[model samples]
Target: MLNELFTLKGKRALITGSSRGIGRAIAMLYAEAGAHVIIHGSKPSAKLDEALAEARALGASAEAVSADIGDINAVKGLIQAVGDVDILVLNASMQHYQTVPDFDPETFALDVNANLRSCFLLLQGFLPGMQQRRFGRIISIGSVNQWRPGARLAIYASTKAAQFNLVLNCARAYAADGITANSISPGVIDTDRNAEALADPAIVEKLRSLVPARRFGSAMDCAGAALLLASPAGAYINGADIAIDGGMKL
Candidate 1:
């Protein structure tokens, strides 16, 4: 019964930015749990193909998709390609570290488009289907930065803060329809995207010291949380931000 509660049999899941890192981990896990997973990447690449192949090898139905979620037209195209998905994981984001004075307006706009606008559009495109079916799971990948902003992360933090609020609002608006929206905030996860930042001994030590866990997290950590939230076990959990940051915010 416990395993059955977490099963995703016959469900379809769309996970963005899934070519690598946390997104990849979630896609793999979802497939293993029985969802037909759609692995999304920014563009067509060998990485996306490999992820699809690997999921199939694990005895899961999977496919690869590509789109620039930052663009409205592209997002529409992506929705058309995906049709309707039972679970939507908004994991694509852009991060530019620049102080307010040094930040470029165009870059800030780009970040907003990617982080906020895309989320809004995807929800709009997918919400109707979910409402009709009376079931949905929307998970946004957030950050600890929303609560603790470091140097030069103004735009990124703002976008993430907005994401959290959006999840709450979505939950309130759709709870009656059996839809749940939530955010998973991760701290310094050891992914290739952060390889350069973690390479410096001083930086690594500084970040590790701040974490109660005293170590960087893994992509699988985020994936584990995602699995619970996207499964039947998490149906009653709505409008909450689950911080998988090794208690960094604490």
Candidate 2:
């Protein structure tokens, strides 16, 4: 029964920005649990192709899509291409590391478009089908910055906070429809995105000291929570924000 609770057999999942990192980990795990997985990237790349191939190698039906989610037109095309899915993972985001005063309008707009607007657009496009099916799971990959706002992550953190609010709204409005919307806020993780920063021992030590866990998180750490939220195990959980931060928020 526990296995059954976690199983995603017959479910179709579309995970955005799945070429690598936490998104790829979730995609791979979903495929292993019997879901037909759709992995996406902003554009075609070897990483995207490799993720797709690896997912298929797990004996699950898998495919890849590419779109710059920051562009409304591209997001529309992505929606048309994906059609309908049981699970939608909003994992793609754009982060700009600039002080609030020094931030440029163009970069701010791009970040908002990709991080917040794209989530709204995707939810709007996919919710109808989910409502009709009476089953849907929406998981927005947020950041710990939502709580521990970084000095240079003003815009990124603001968008993530807004995104979680959107999740709460959807969860409240769609609970009766058998749809669940949640967010996962990950703390410092050892992914390619942090490779450069973490490469510096001083920076790594400083960040590590901040987390009670005293260690960096892995993509798989986030993936485990994502699986729980995506499968039957989390059927009754809604409007929840799970922090995969290892007590960093505290």
Candidate 3:
């Protein structure tokens, strides 16, 4: 049953912010593992549809839904569009790294809404169905900053911490119904958005020094842990915040 433990042969997963970055990678991987995936994002993007279609071509059912996750009305509309869900992956998040003198109120609020509040909204829509079915997996993508707060990102760090604790609370509240809640805190991942920061020789050196593994994480690193918790292999795992940071906090 080893393969069965990791197989998502007939599952349905809803992944938010899947147009690019880590979200996109996770969506594609989950589909490859045999789950019907619903690609979600803010506003409709042809590219997102393309990703969904590609997954369908790979022998998995997939679709795309566009919704501004931070907007309650929009999120409600999107939820009504897709009725019930078996798996939920809250991977949409916003970040603003600005020093005190330059930080803007609007930007900070946007980060809070996207990173923390949006998670609440999504769960509000899907949790009930999961409870009724007595089977569900909810995984939220958090940040390493929650455990290792960084400079110029206090607000982002706060939201990540919120995700971590919320998972525990949600798990405890829903476990008896056979639903599981978990979070993945990823370290500095090598993505298009982070290339510039990591390209700086000094910053690169610093990052390497900070992580015991002396390397940056790839989308695959976080995706691997996510799949584990969202699959049968993690049936007994709940109320957990898994860290995939290559020992950066030590």
Candidate 4:
């Protein structure tokens, strides 16, 4: 029963920004769990190819696609390429580290387009099939910043907060249709995006001190929550935000 609950056998999943980091971790896990995976990146790269090969090696049917999620045309093409998926992971996002006062308008728009608008567009394109099938899992990769705003993450945090709200709205509206919408908020994960900052001892120590766990999280730390949310075990869970942030929000 436990095995059945966590299994993703026969599910088709499309995971965006899956060439590396947290997205890649989730894609790999999903593939291992028996899902036909679709890996996506902003553009074709060795990392994307590697992720595709790795997923296929896991004995899961997998394919790769590339698109700038911030662009409507590209997103449309991505939607056309992917067709329909039982699981849609909205993990692609743009983060700019600048204070509110210093934020450039263009940068802010790009962040909004990538992080918030893209989620909406993907949902628009895919939710109908989910509603029809009456079995869909929408997992949006959020951030701890949605709860505890960071000093330099004003725009990024705001978009994430708004994105979570969108998830909640979907959860409420789609529960009867067998669709679950949830967000996972990960804190200070040791991904490539944070490599430069984590390389400095002082910065790493300062960040670690804030977490009660007193350590940084790994990309795999977030993947387990994603697996639960995407599988039968989390069927009853909806309109929820699971924080993988080792008490950082506290």
User: What does candidate 1's lDDT look like per residue over 1-250, in tens digits?
Assistant: 9889899999999999999999999999999999999999989999989999989999999999999988889999999999999999999998887877888789989999999999999999999999999999999999999988767888999999998899899999999999999999999999988898899999999999989999889999999999999999999999989999899989
- Candidates 2 and 4: which is better by lDDT? 2
RMSD of 4: 0.7
lDDT of 2 by residue, 1-250 (tens): 9889999999999999999999999999999999999999999999999999999999999999999999999999999999999999999999988889988899999999999999999999999999999999999999999989998899999999999999999999998999999999999999998899899999899899999999999999999999999998899999999999889998
Runs in model 2 with CA error above 4 Å? none
The reply for model 4, stretches above 4 Å from the true place, is none
Better structure of 1 and 4 per lDDT: 4
Candidate 1, after superposition: displacement of residue 55 in Å? 0.9
The candidate scoring highest on lDDT is 2
Model 2: colliding residue pairs: none
Clash pairs (backbone) in predicted model 1: none
Give the TM-score of each candidate: 0.98, 0.99, 0.94, 0.99
Clash count of each predicted structure: 0, 0, 0, 0
lDDT of 1 at 99: 79
Poorest stretch of ten by lDDT in candidate 1: 96-105
Clashing pairs in 4: none
Model 4: per-residue lDDT, tens digit, 1-250? 9889989999999999999999999999999999999999999999999999999998888999999999999998999989989999999999998999999889999999999999999999999999999989999999999999988999999999999999999999999999999999999999998899899999998899999999889999999999999999999999899999899999
